[model samples]
Target chain A: MSQGPVRKILLFVDGSEECITAAQYAVVLARTLGAELAALYVVNVSVLNELFKARIFIKMEQMDYEHDLEQDGRRYLNYISELGRAKGVSIETHIEKGVVNEVVVEKARILGADLLAMGELEPIKSRSDAFHDESELILRKAHCSVLVVKDADYIERLYQAME
Target chain B: MRISGLLSEKTISRLTRTDKQGVIEELLDLAMNSGQVHDREEALRAILAREALMSTGLEKGIAVPHAKTRAVSEITMALGVSEGGVDFHSADGKPSYIFFFLLAPENAAGPNVQVLAQIARLTHDRSFCEDLRKAESPAGMLAVINDAE
Candidate 1:
């Protein structure tokens, strides 16, 4: 008998605080559908320039705490891997040095992933309520189905239900 | 402003004060130091109060927690480099690196969108994030950001 199309999930990570939100969603989806998780990080190599002078921007008494936005990506991927291992889910990670949306979508296509999970870059503070939201701009433009997660709670709901 | 609006390189950790209280304190400090905010405590409370409503953590090792304030005359930004990443409670479950502690007057919405779009443009580049991590010093990090702009 013929089988349905395979459902692979692609996650875009940027070492931003929001990645945590993206991972939560991807992890639950991976566990439920028994799909594989592919984590990818796009490394931007242009932060080391001189004209920008945007580095070493802060410190505590001459100590170098230059942000390690890239190194932390590996650490995060490890965390995702651990979460997957514990859940008995298959997980894979890819770190590419390029643009964020382009590399993420490209990686997903190369892997034939069906879904893309990502977090917001910034949040909007309004009088009504503060919104933790990602740009629907990228989501709408993505080739595959995009699941933009605003809250980390959605993942918890899945875990609670699964349990 | 060559082009991009990222902040000073990563630091050992300024918001050394962890927790929600600490984050609010640091954000207040940033907004004030930015000269855009008139009152540190007020701005801090504003940002923290917003966070209490919902965490700004976006998931993927980044968080953009901010608040609206009448104190700020224009949109101002600050960079909080955390050595010991905080538990921002991001959706993906990771810490933050490049924090854009944004503050603007309650009235201006255009500048807010302009800055957000700029931030999005920066993240859109992966090599930029890679270079950000590779940077060992503040100058190195700034150099990368400048070139990207």
Candidate 2:
């Protein structure tokens, strides 16, 4: 009941180490199934920008700093994606403006992805899946299976299993 | 380094603040006073509201209080180590001692995925959590965290 051979995986990242860990795990899957990978970064809206702008002089100087941050985010995503790209994994990035949880689901649907790999929070989520906390939410909303990743060492496991 | 990262001082506080609400308020105040957040009350409300939707406490005595907003410019983080664990109403029912309060711009959602991924990596390490628990003060805790990074 799925299109093609489940060869496309969507990954959501937030410039955190867990995100890089999730990306590492995703590369293993992409390599195994020859799946394409897409990394997404969402900058959850800043309350500081709104309140400060409303009450005081909206400093272009400070706002410029914010713009630079967005660039840094893109660079971080690019660096992570480069790893997958080296492994012959088709990797791409998308930066959108919105909330984290909501946008995560939205991007998955739009990508027509077969699987979503997220870093898992163990002891609560399987030490192998990050979305263990919100798997139900993402699983219920997305038209795909969400595999929350636990750690990069699992990639060794994936490779060993493949061998 | 991004200014957000600087907010994570290499310090550990042997604070004894008990419970979730108390920690939340204390952390919010610290975040505000440090200028980590623009509106103290508003950010607190957002964190509380997010908690209502679901506890930010994932596991391993780690609770990440995060909110997606259109109010800030970039993704900012504030971390605290409470000697006593705080009840996060986690789905798995665990007390989280390490707290990471994250702030993102109103139009920032993609960063959340990356941020979560990074956190997972940090949390999977037993040594990291063990050291956090062993921290004597806030500066010490931050030092350990920064050293890990």
Tell me each candidate's i-RMS in Å.
15.3, 13.0
Q: Which segments of model 1 are wrong by more than 4 Å?
A: A1-6, A46-67, A124-137, A160-163, B1-149
The docking category that best describes candidate 1 is: incorrect
Over the stretch B68-149, how does candidate 1's per-residue lDDT look in tens digits? 6776777767655566677777656777655556766665433453454455456557787666656666567667667665
lDDT of 2 by residue, B53-107 (tens): 6677775677777665543466666667766677777646877787766766655
Give the true-contact fraction for every prediction, in order: 0.00, 0.00
DockQ per model, Cα: 0.03, 0.04
lDDT of 2 at A156: 50
lDDT of 1 at B35: 52
- lDDT digits (tens) for residues A1-163 of candidate 2: 2234766788877665676778877887777776778888765444224322322112542354356556767887888777777666668888875555677788888887888877653333233233433434565677778887775676656644542
Worst 10 residues of 2 chain B by lDDT: B2-11
Chain B TM, every candidate = 0.79, 0.82
List per-prediction Cα lDDT, in the order shown: 0.59, 0.64
Share of the reference A-B contacts seen in candidate 1: 0.00
Give each model's clash number.
60, 60
